[model samples]
Target: MRFMTTSDKPENATGGESAADDTAEVTGIAAQDWDRASADPQYRAAVVDLLGALAYGELAAFERLAEDAKLAPTLVDKAELAKMAAAEFHHFERLAGRLTEIGEEPTRAMEPFVDALDGFHKQTAPSDWLEGLVKAYVGDSIASDFYREVAAHLDSDTRGLVLAVLDDTGHAGFAVEKVRAAIDEDPRVGGRLALWARRLMGEALSQSQRVVADRDALSTMLVGGVADGFDLAEVGRMFSRITEAHTKRMAALGLAA
Candidate 1:
């Protein structure tokens, strides 16, 4: 396993101070309202795909968090997980509402994603309480980062909704605290959790790529086919930023990246 030192923690992966200015100037889509942006059929299709994937993801997070709560060692932990699960469900409702508002059937929109997302959950099922916590933190954060990257290129109204739904449901600090405590009590646990996190990382990234690749409209929107969307190089940089953020998260849990 690779261990991260203090110096290895890079700057915040969300581009530096000028990222906002850069996005506004470069992606003309960033400034437009959804009504104006959705006039393009391809962009509308991409947004539908995006919202579908996110709605299902939030729904799944709710389910998984509820199931994982059963493994919590204390009532406090269980309650915290339950609260987060409720928040996840709320996010799901918002996404589904947006889909309906856009004249898309929520079930139909989310159908295309259920299989892939469910497969990810099955493959990355946590073995124990600590593993579940790591999955919640590391796995969920990676997805959030990807959505945030895509949101930067989206129109103003859609970007606001996407970012709002991706908000952390209080899982970050809770997971970090619980996982670090477990590691502190037993140093050997860190290695196993680190390995588990790496597996989650691989599966999550693969699922993300597969989701985009399977949807032509979404893939086109991502690869510069839409208004100033990400070029290939930007896609690479986005993944790098994601990886860096994962490393920092692992370090926060006192685990090697």
Candidate 2:
């Protein structure tokens, strides 16, 4: 993924910075560029909130996938899940660094999202390996789509960062293949997995609404508030696009959306 610019150590760099931070500073464009681009307070706040939410979401996904890896029936399956978990962690580290470079405390930026994300995970905990796979595929796809949609409204640098981190590293195909093969072997399992996917979607939508309500700036930007702001009709159309994508993904998994 392409990053913006590389910069020297922030004169205030603490020895405690992680390797991800070091790598980001070396590869990323100078922080001053981001600061200048986000001159508008509202735009800056929305961008910060968006990055924070994404950062926290990736971190939570990493933890959840790692836990689900234990449910894999075979060593091969476990290894695949572990790879996905690692990918999520890599995305999280990139996002965290971007947050810091933009002058936001990564932890503080992510803190507000903890409850919303954690609650969604708790509510949609998988019952078995199949359910977990479906959750990973459907849930992550929805998130990636949503971020991609929002990225269109962002400045070039921020949009590049968002799109880059959202790259799924081909894990969606892995999940879809595993789930579809399992269903083919046991026809009845498809019904159960289909129902689980629906439940995941519902829980995700609920949590997303909660996040929007809690983050005014981010919500505004999402609904077209960044420049001219999106009208209700356009927002409806935007959601329709998201729903259409979800339907196609579900069909790929041989499940109903």
Candidate 3:
């Protein structure tokens, strides 16, 4: 994974940062003359395709999570998830703007990878509220780790955008708690959720492979003895972390991981 500037700090997120400055931070990425990069054409296409997919992924995630938030059992839980979902909408707008600043039409740029991401979601759509939380907790976190990896390849503004969109621990924790609560109500959910989580991972990998197939600039094949962007090792490590979290969540609900 390449290292780049990403504003993961809470202060740099939507709350403290001026909305107008978002344009400046994004413009910094545009300053880099992408046309000058002499990387493999496939590699460049790969990177763009990945970013485009993530850009649209956030958009779809926001819509789905917001709708799912209505499943919250209590008014407070409903409000909390709904607010988090709105935060995602704001993130979607910023990412879309960054894509435009980088010289790509947000919608058009996102088109190539749409099938993969959307298809992944469709195949692994959660069966129940607990499964939905598991999907949110696992899927969004993995995507964040991936985003951080890509941020390394971008300039400061792009890096900041990537970091800004990362899921906050607080929100993820809330979802985790919700999942545990549901599971505690019935231990049988343990096996079901585990399978659901695995399905999510499988679907994610399937879409990811499709993305890496044509584009080499992002995580191109072993190029010059090194993969360009994302690699299995890094993804595996991320999955290890996710697995740990999943285990902890399952234990909290009185089940084995």
Candidate 4:
């Protein structure tokens, strides 16, 4: 999928996007030159695919985190979650600035993956603090990993912006404490949490496939120019790192990993 930045309705550019079905035109600001890759269609497409995905991801993650904050046990904990959630919006604003600098509306740039990315959040909505941490720990780790991959292929300025939003430890301590306490109250919670973790991995993997297939440029950037080039080895490495981190956090909470 070639995603060219459009301040004008991108999804409605040719009426082929699923969103185009509802509105004949996305109808927003005029298209501008928001990308450094404008000199080449493939390059432009690649950058837009990266930014579009990143933008939508930030927007969606913020909303999910904000809602999930309500699951916290105390007002202080809730405020911490809210604070972390606000970081996503700050990221959105930073990304939107870049999009506008190059001449694309943030909303229009993010419209393409509206369904797939948003769908992942809706289906994987957290029910409580543990689930919320699973969402943050597992979800943020993978997203940051992917961003690191694509950012490597870009110029320093753009890449720095991308790298700046990597996995945040913003509320990991609180989450760890909460998860540990819950498990301590009921030892059986360990089994349920492990199972829940597996389910999270499954759903995340499924959604990742959708993202890889939907945006070829993104896939290329991730896999060093081959669509399926990044195999189990790379993913296993990410899994191992995240798992180790989770294990340590769990141990800190007196929960056996």
Which candidate wins on TM-score? 1
- Which parts of model 2 are misplaced by more than 4 Å? 1-33, 226-230
lDDT of 2: 0.77
Residue 242, candidate 1: C-alpha displacement in angstroms: 0.6
Candidate 1 on 1-257: residue-level lDDT in tens? 00011122212121312132333333355556799768767778888998998999999999999999999999998999999999999999999999999899999999989988999999999989999999999878988888877886687799899999988788998898888888899999999998999899889878878887789887766653433444576567768988999998798888888
Query: How do the residues 1-257 of candidate 4 rate in per-residue lDDT, one tens digit apiece?
Result: 12212223245332212212233332211122223335545556667777888988888888888888888778987898899889888888888888887777778878877888887887887777777876676677667755664554464466677888664747565666677778888988777777676677678778877977888666654443332244445445545665676556545655455
C-alpha lDDT values of all predictions = 0.80, 0.77, 0.61, 0.64
Per-residue CA lDDT of model 3 for 171-237, tens digit only, reads 6788777777777787687778777776777787778768767555555322211324444665565
Winner on TM-score between 3 and 4 is: 4
TM-score of 3: 0.71
lDDT (0-100) at residue 192 of candidate 3?
Answer: 82
- How good is model 4 by TM-score? 0.73
Off by over 4 Å in 4: 1-38, 167-169, 226-257
Per-model root-mean-square deviation over C-alphas = 7.5, 9.9, 8.6, 11.3
TM-score, per-candidate, Cα-based = 0.87, 0.84, 0.71, 0.73
lDDT of 3: 0.61
lDDT of 1 at 160: 96
Model 3, 224: alpha-carbon shift in Å?
Answer: 8.6
User: Clash pairs of candidate 1?
Assistant: none
